[model samples]
Target: MTSDPEEQVRLQGFGEMTLRTAVATLMQLAPGERADAAIFRVRDDVRLAQSEIAELASHWGIEPAPNVRSPGLVPDQHWPDVVRGMVREAPLPSLMVAFLVGMLVARR
Candidate 1:
């Protein structure tokens, strides 16, 4: 919320850089690790909710869904490599897409 356009652009660039760095860091993590992290976050959230609503905790005995492995065109393990290859092959298009997404998110 700055009056200066240059300052706004600088801040936007910083935000985009931070987002890109976070994405790159996540991409470096193994798929299994990512899944585990997501599960942990959900577990923490559920624990917090249960703590806040003690009476509802008893009703929240939901079972986890069974893991059904579906055959994908590209196997799970190679996904990160394939995505990296795609971005390497078409850097400009990827950057444009990222920029557009950032703009849309910023507008919101």
Candidate 2:
């Protein structure tokens, strides 16, 4: 969206400041070489991984959305740690588990 001039300006109004504007403003304050445009996109297959995680947690008697915090089970706070521990204990599905946990953490 930042590539298009109009969209860049519109994004700024929406508080999604464009990198182009930030770089330009910075350049004026401190002289520097011309800046380049950079865009980033993140894609995650959360549905599949989350399903797998829930299935695993269920086997461990940890409800997918557990309310209580307890050892060897899902905790309300730092719940992602519980998920990661389960993933590490299992020999299989390590990659998928890591990805799911990462997606969960990043979203939070």
Candidate 3:
């Protein structure tokens, strides 16, 4: 029901976490069941799509976002047109990653 796209994504992430927790609890409660049985039970009871459990497991187990690109190696082109505009009259350093990669270009 939110008009904000960021809010909707946050809500969706919260809902996914709740569902994952519930499924994990149920799996733990069924002590005698096989791992595959627990997966099937979750699929049948919660009506999730095929491979979604595996996908969720993979996603949840992933490490936090990697530092793929280094911050110090930013292109020279961004220094002029983009980085100069986000400056505030404070001591905080400018964040150029979003601007260098075009994330903040259209918004400005």
Please report the candidate that would top TM-score against the real structure.
3
When summed lDDT is taken over every stretch of 10 residues in candidate 1, the lowest stretch is: 1-10
lDDT of 1 by residue, 1-108 (tens): 111212211111123222223233333445554333311111122211222222222233322333445656534668888878877888697779987999999999
TM-score of each: 0.22, 0.17, 0.24
Candidate 2: residue 58 Cα off by (Å): 33
RMSD of each: 18.3, 20.9, 14.7
Give stretches of model 3 more than 4 Å off. 1-17, 26-46, 62-108
- Shift in Å, residue 66, candidate 2: 22
Error of 1 at 65 (Å): 39
Candidate 1: which stretches are off by over 4 Å? 1-75, 91-94
lDDT of 3 by residue, 1-108 (tens): 111212211111123234445344433432333133332222234344325544554555522233335667755666665546646533443345544657667767
Give the better candidate number (1 or 2) by lDDT.
Answer: 2
